[model samples]
Target: MQEILDRAKDCYDSGLPFVVYRKPNETDVFGVFQSNDELRSSKDFTEKGFVFAPFNDDNQVVLLQPDEVWEGKYQTEKSEAIKDINLDESGKEVHIELVKKGIQEIETGRLQKVVLSRKIQVRITKPPFKIFKTLLSKYPNAFAYFIHHPKVGTWCGATPETLVKVKDKKLKTMSLAATLPFIEDETPKWGNKEIEEQQMVSEYIGDKLAHTMERLEIDEAESVRAGNLWHLRSEVRGTMLPNLKVSEVVRALHPTPAVCGIPTDEAQKFIHKNENYKRTFYTGFLGELNLRSQGELSLFVNLRCMELQGDTASIFVGGGITEASDPESEWIETQNKSKTMLGIL
Candidate 1:
């Protein structure tokens, strides 16, 4: 671990990119250098020689070949099977209660922010990790990461959040992911609440990207649901100024408002104070870098994720909080989102 960390630090210092991975055998560490010798088209970046690492338990950031790619996805029908599974609180009910709680806290001036989370129970008659591995292999674009420590069993996920994407003069990013279990025939809709949250994320990102890019284009976003929840997503594209570096863009976009929350610092401080848990790598971004190419970057938000051990999986889940948010509902949202991975278990 120390050696890998040292190598990473060295790469950072030398202005290059690298990836460190924990192989399936558990205990084997591997490292790869991103090819930055040339600047290939962005299309090539998504199609060839890409690798991925754990961005968080549920999310993975991928570095692709810009050419070689596979099409894989899993969207389950709204399962009566899921209805049978036990959940801590009815999601709708929790939303109402948590919102009231958050409102009261704000009303009383206790906290300006609080992130709530809940767990959904899943019963599996078959081996859970095996099912997860199958899902990981299925999504060729997603990262297949699992660690088998004595403390945690098998952890895996196929995340879709792009923490950051940097090219020579361009940087792009997305915001606001909500997780819920997959439902059959669920079409994408731009509802009021979804639009509202997405708007906030877009505004925040536009502000950040403005400082780094000379020209920026914000797109009309659609709804994307990962695992059990749905998120409002917008694509923000910008061209970096002559003096800016790719690392600067990455540093600016990480832990965006979608995954973290608005009033970033205050929200993070509140999370540390009240969430009563350590996020560790849960929300951190991870992916490969193509130092050999002109520096193509693909990152994902660490959502719909879990930590895998031999026989036990310690799943980590959370939700974003806003001044307009409800704590109970946030809790249920995380629970519902956890279903993305929990269903397999």
Candidate 2:
């Protein structure tokens, strides 16, 4: 573990690209160290390296060549923190207004749904690697990763949403949406708006997979807890059609309704015009793409994530907005979502 950290620090100091990650529910951690400072991209999954893509297709997909690899079991420890993050009330009001505008568009039938997001900047006292270690110890069930590239910047996240997973001819994905703070005493009672929001994502994923899957199956929706919040989740599985490439599947499933909205192009346009911030890689998917040795691919939605630069961290959070969405409640939901990263900080 110490060696991996030291190597990562060396790479960062030397301006080399590298990525270290621990897959969901696994104790083993893997690191890929690129030999050069070049930024690489791939459209097909034939490359043998780690891929870091952005939310926007126009942006470059950064890849780190697997020149050096390290694997070790992550040592887990309790994380103690002294600070509490306060919600930005003014920022919340601004996001609420954006949600209201989205709702008005929905009422007029411009789009069925839209995912709105906001960024919160916070001052940090701990080293970025220390916070990343805390995240690894905290969220064992999430795809925890710390990626650094001189050209692309540094990001660390513990994402709970799986964009897609493929092994052999079988493919697996999930529709994850509808967030609320978790309570210990009782079962979560989801409102109609939450239920419908989740349903839209499930239906959209199923429809999209139909294009490349010979047979598709969607499981019943259920409530799953991630950190301090609960979200509605549904698993979708299918057998891949003959000759279906990894890029095609990714193009179809990415920026799902869970992250974007129904009628993807229109919702994306709305977000681009009104969100007033660059999403960069917040909602983008990242992970191994068709690893040659394993013959499998696993990618996750970039949520519960933060970009570390010097002593400041930029945290990103968002939620799906339908016509039945409440602007105030949506604001609260993002605050709850922020706890996933803030707690470890």
Candidate 3:
């Protein structure tokens, strides 16, 4: 860690922005990359960088350069706790209460879609980045990210959600996801509500990208079940502008309505005010800036994340709250999401 930190500092001093991270569950090899003007790929893993899979199901790695590497340490304040938070509020008043609140928001026009999150505290000293790397190498579909700063240590997740993807001036994005626990051989059916929710997301993204790209191609996406929940997902592809920086596109589209909310500013404000937690980097996006190629950035929402504060590990979880969304069901959804990593613990 010290060696990489020192090297990153050197690169920063030399005016080169870089990012460093480790895949979940893998050791000895960490991801590193130096920013370039365009996108490229690497077959040889000599230069430290991230290895990304081409498709969602491809368990391949893509080497990337980061702008910063962060290592986080949790610090607790001196305060007496009131009550013990439940690990999975599958059947509880809290779940119902949250859904009701979301309904109210919908009725009042505060938001069209809002993503809610919760923090889970586990007891352990193992660095989360270490586990993150393991997941990366093991899950071909999983993605890993870690952003280290002096004051903040933020890591990445092995999420299947694609905020956006670009190659050879061809751009693609997805409306992913509304999730429930994955059940085997369930026939992957999409009810009216699920399909409608997914369509909303797809249309929103397509409209958002329409002016920037030409000839958009949208296809019917299927349902993707993760852990204990299922989400509605769709893929939207198009051609990029002749001169559009991958970074520019990323900045324009990150913290999407799927993760944040529609009228994103209002939804984010509500979240900060009502959620009653410092999300730090929970829903933020992090990935490689430049890989074996130039102008390529792979960033994923910081979901399924846990923070190591001393001997305590706090895992974060949340769900999208819509007008049609029930607070109780939303809460249960989060509980189900928590089970994904809690099982590992």
Candidate 4:
């Protein structure tokens, strides 16, 4: 464990590309160190390394060529609460207005739903490596990773949403939506708006997978907690057709109703027209592709994450907005979500 940490620090200090990650509910930690500073792209998924893809398909998908791979087992450590950083009031107002606009579109029947997001930049007093370690200790149930590339910059996150996982002929995914603040020893209650929103995502996933899957199964939705918030989630599994490829499964699953909206294309257009900021890698997916000699893949949505640039950290948060959604309440939901990353800092 100490060797992995030391090597990761050396890679970071030398400005070389590398990715260190641990999957949810797993004790094993994995790191891939690239030999050179070159940034490579993976279009066919034939390359053997970690892939960092963006939300938009037009952008390049950065790949970290594995010059060396290391694995270690470590016991989970308890987390300590860090001070909360206050969000900019002006920025909150702007995000609320964006949500209102999305609601108006839904009401007019132009779109059934659209996910809105805001990026908050916070000044960091601690080193990024320490924050990365804190994230792993705090979110043991998340897909946590720290990726650095000379071309793409440095990014880290502890994501709860699994976009897709493939091993041999089997494929698995999940539809996660809705949000409520978690209280100790209290039952989580979901409003109609949340229920409907989560359902839309599940149905959308089922429909998309049907095209390429030989057999598909979906489980009932249930409440799952992540840090200070609780979300409704449903698991989806299937056996892929022989002709289907890894890239095809990713395309069908990513930017689902949970992150994009009910009708994928239309919702994406609205976001591009109004969000007022580029999502970049915020809602993007990242993980190992074709790991080892065997064909096993694990990819996750980029949530509960931040981008480190010098001393400032840009935190990303978003929520699904429907016709019944309230602008102020949605704003508060994002604030609660941001705490997942903020508490580690």
Q: Stretches of candidate 4 above 4 Å error?
A: 84-87
lDDT of 2 by residue, 1-345 (tens): 778888999998999999899999999889899999988987677777888888888897777788999988888887675366665666867898999999998898989999999998889978989888988988889999999998888999999999988898799999999988888987899999999989989998988889899999999899998877889999999999988887889899878898899999899999999996999999998998655554478889988899988889999988899998889888888888877777777
lDDT of 3 by residue, 137-194 (tens): 4344444444333223333355666666566777767778677667777756665656
The regions of model 2 sitting more than 4 angstroms off are 81-84, 292-295
Per-model RMSD to reference: 10.2, 1.3, 10.1, 1.3
lDDT of 2 at 217: 94
TM-score between candidate 4 and the true structure: 0.97
lDDT for every model?
A: 0.53, 0.88, 0.58, 0.88
Of candidates 3 and 1, the better by lDDT: 3
Per-residue lDDT of 275 in model 3: 70
Poorest 10 consecutive residues of model 3 by lDDT?
52-61
Q: Tens-digit lDDT track for model 4 on 156-274?
A: 98999898989987988998999999999998989999999999888889999999999999999999998788999999999999988878888888788888897888899899889
Q: How accurate locally is residue 19 in candidate 3, as Cα lDDT from 0 to 100?
A: 48
Clashes of 2: 0
The TM-score between candidate 3 and the true structure equals 0.72
Angstrom error at residue 302, model 1: 1.6
Q: Which stretches of candidate 3 lie over 4 Å from their true place?
A: 1-30, 33-96, 125-130, 154-156
How much is the lDDT of residue 291 in candidate 3?
A: 48
